[model samples]
Target: MATQQTSAAGDAHGGTDTSPERWVVGVDGSPGARAALVWALAAAARAGARLELVSTYPADFYWTDPYLLDTVRLDEIRADTAGLVRAALAEARRDPALAAVPGAAEVPTDVVVGGGAAAAQLVEQAQGAQRLVVGSRGRSGVRSTLLGSVALHCVAHAPCPVVVVHPGAVQPPPRVVVGIDDTDVSREALREAAEEARRLGAELEVVAACPLEVVWSNIYSVVAPPAEETRARARERAEIVVAEVLGADAPVRLRVEDGEPAEALPRVAAGAVLLVVGSRSRSRIAGMLLGSVALHCVVHAPCPVMVVHPQPARAAGRPAADPAAAAAR
Candidate 1:
């Protein structure tokens, strides 16, 4: 029983350090964990943060297993856990992309044998981490039991900025796709997207997905212009929002489309690394009946998505996003 320590440690690429700056990934025997290992190694190589690969399981079951009194059962569990960890590590090494990472050879791996709940353990490890990377699915849970339970839990409550990587989430020559609208939520999304694009050294793309309103005014149609003009106006409005959130100097490429928010984002992110969207602004009654667009994107987007809560109007004078507060931690 290794005691849990508050102090953090790094991996051996340059000799593990005790700084709280390491990049962490949670690995269980799931497809998502395997993807997370690859993602973590690549990120560690890029960010120069040591990789911390950890696998956690319930320890109570092991200690209380009366059947474990049979030496066979005890040994079997030990062997199974060790094999799972070893396999995960080996799978990571075999990935051409991850194995090719500059620091992949030096990334140290560790196995944590204990259990409260896997999601809780992973979230605990995420605290103080530079970033928390996890695959989209894991062991089952109570409500979202049908989806990737572990990823779902961590996204809702992890202390750090959590990135849930789905298998096909990574895009090439990446672009940052941001959903925009009239509200401050879209403003926050724009700001976050710009920052991420800078981090990944990619281009920022600002997009607005809206439904066209039709009005039957004969005189208005005779003098009014095409829908393209309306779209242009919407685009200009989005540009103002983008500028407000990202500042005049923020690098951005503009795009406007007419479609459902959910459909538009996936299409725009086809070759992008990430999609940033604002949490849906739903009335209490509406939210209970149907989930918002942001929630849907988290579950189904072709790429990783970051959902930001828009600051209240009263907070307009405050900083764009406080790094510490922006992260749930």
Candidate 2:
């Protein structure tokens, strides 16, 4: 295993020194990884953020017995990884897309061996990064991993927000879509989506979903109230989110439908530049890494999905999202 120190070394592209604002992207030479790289480059240009292209492998490549290297030489792996990063950099330079950006010239890029499993390395390396971008699918062994699993891990655990870029997604329309509930995390998502919309000179659409029925499980189940009642309740909840959580001055369009966020959100997000959702929030179905709705959008949204972490504690413990805490903040 290469020492953690060497693993993090950005020596492949000179030294570890990087741009003030950096966005990390895992580059595994897959079509998905390349797409994410392209997106990250354009986004960096827009946000004045630099790019960090990374590829990782098990530590056994260097630390374990020579026989365990699996016929793959460390030097060879390093060269290939560097070459991928270089190609991404070249793409950034040659693409006409970034030519008009004002500060594009200043954003520097670095390629490094993240040194570990794809998800863990990205989450660790992205600690101080502005954002981490990954493609929804990937197909390289050792140095590359499909984002299906890796994207889930990073969105839930990365210190900063995570963006899952879908391959061949049409250029998003002038709008941003967000799913919000009467929860801090959802409110956080709302703000992020709104800000993104504003920055892109697009409309901001806020949606809330309400389940028509309540599942009491194996015990005695109680039927839900009428649709009118549910709609009223959902509307009231959205009002509170807009008033208390979002404040009156925030520019947005609030719409409340059924609380089935997964079903409700993707439809609203259609043709949007981005879909923003909380990793964890107050909802009927929830889990540790990602709430059902967030996961759904990450996998099936029409455009890129930005999973926002509301607070630090839940993410730190990396526990199932707390429903009660939704009101805490």
Q: Output the lDDT of residue 84, model 2.
A: 62
Q: Which stretches of candidate 2 lie over 4 Å from their true place?
A: 1-20, 61-76, 92-106, 140-148, 168-173, 214-224, 281-291, 312-329
Q: What would the TM-scores of all predictions be?
A: 0.71, 0.75
Q: Hey, what RMSD does candidate 2 come out at?
A: 7.6
User: Taking the tens digit of each residue's C-alpha lDDT, what string does model 1 give over 183-287?
Assistant: 866776666666566656676788888656566977777676677887888888887886676665555688888877877787777767777877644333322
Model 1 TM? 0.71
For model 1, give the 10-residue run with minimal summed lDDT.
Answer: 1-10
lDDT of each: 0.64, 0.68
- Cα deviation in Å at residue 263, candidate 1? 2.4
Clashes of each: 3, 9
Best by lDDT: 2
- Minimal lDDT window, size 10, model 2: 3-12
